[model samples]
Target: MAVAAVTTKRKRTTARPTKTQPTTNAKLIKQPLPAGLPREWYETHNRRLKAMRLAIALLDTGIYHPANASNRRIRTAAERIGIHPPSETTCRMVRSLIHYAD
Candidate 1:
């Protein structure tokens, strides 16, 4: 007597595709100011005034605090004179002015 040969078949499996969902809620993060100022200030003096205003705000808010009181007063004077005070990182940029003497 001869036994019949048995055959077995293996099944192939395929990976299922992944599904992605869009995010509905996301928070925006504050970023640093761009490299240059806005174009509204065509005159150099106007740009300087704007810079002075920003510097004053920064100083008042303690963003650039720990600075010497004398330096702060100097910066305030510069703001009043339409001369934008230099940034804290470049405080040396401010120029000195002298009145005419007889």
Candidate 2:
């Protein structure tokens, strides 16, 4: 005796796709840094800012856990957010920021 195979059809939705809003190109006003600050301090400050931006971008993209924020993934997020590609150190900083976020 031969057995017959059965197939099931999947249902499709007729909902229309919504248009995504375009991103704004607003420029941020620069604040002057205080004089006499060490060069390392400036570097660290910028690194922290970039990391924070990356962390927020990742969070916006549904990556709430730091474990899921690998370097490549973080870089991709940065690209999506229109940021320059971050360095290895900056990627680590972004993960740390995500880990410490409440």
Candidate 3:
């Protein structure tokens, strides 16, 4: 009696998706804030901008959940993005942004 050999197919593996950087060289021009604005207004505006930046940085680093964005993590992300360490208020803002992003 002759026996037939059985063949098995191997499973294919796919690589995990990696974050991609912008290929364009687009740059943003820093226009000075409108003249005669109140100091508090300027401060608030700058703080909001910083929070947005930190949030984006954290997202890019694979931090999609707000729970993952601790004060230390947010501050570290700010430092990595060349910004000063964020205040507690700013950290909360960043987490809020991450949370609402979904």
Q: Pick the candidate with the highest lDDT.
A: 3
Candidate 3 lands at a TM-score of 0.71
Q: Looking at model 3, how many pairs of residues clash?
A: 0
Question: What overall lDDT, based on C-alpha atoms, would model 3 receive against the true structure?
Answer: 0.87
Which has the better lDDT: candidate 1, or candidate 3?
Answer: 3
The best candidate by TM-score is: 3
Model 2 superposed RMSD (Cα): 15.8
Error of 2 at 34 (Å): 1.1
What TM-score does model 1 achieve against the real structure? 0.24
Instruction: Give each prediction's root-mean-square deviation over alpha carbons.
Output: 20.8, 15.8, 12.4
Candidate 3 lDDT, 11-98, residue by residue in tens:
7695544344333464554668899988999988989999999999999999999999999999989888899999999999999999
In candidate 2, what are the lDDT values of residues 1-102, reduced to their tens digit? Answer: 233333555667754433443235545557698879999999999999999999999989889888999999999998988989999999999988888884
CA displacement after TM-score superposition, residue 30 of candidate 2 (Å): 4.2
lDDT of 1 by residue, 27-102 (tens): 4545554557756534445445455454454455444432333457656755665665755533432221111110
Instruction: Compute the lDDT of residue 12 as modeled in candidate 1.
Output: 60
Give the alpha-carbon lDDT of every model.
0.45, 0.85, 0.87
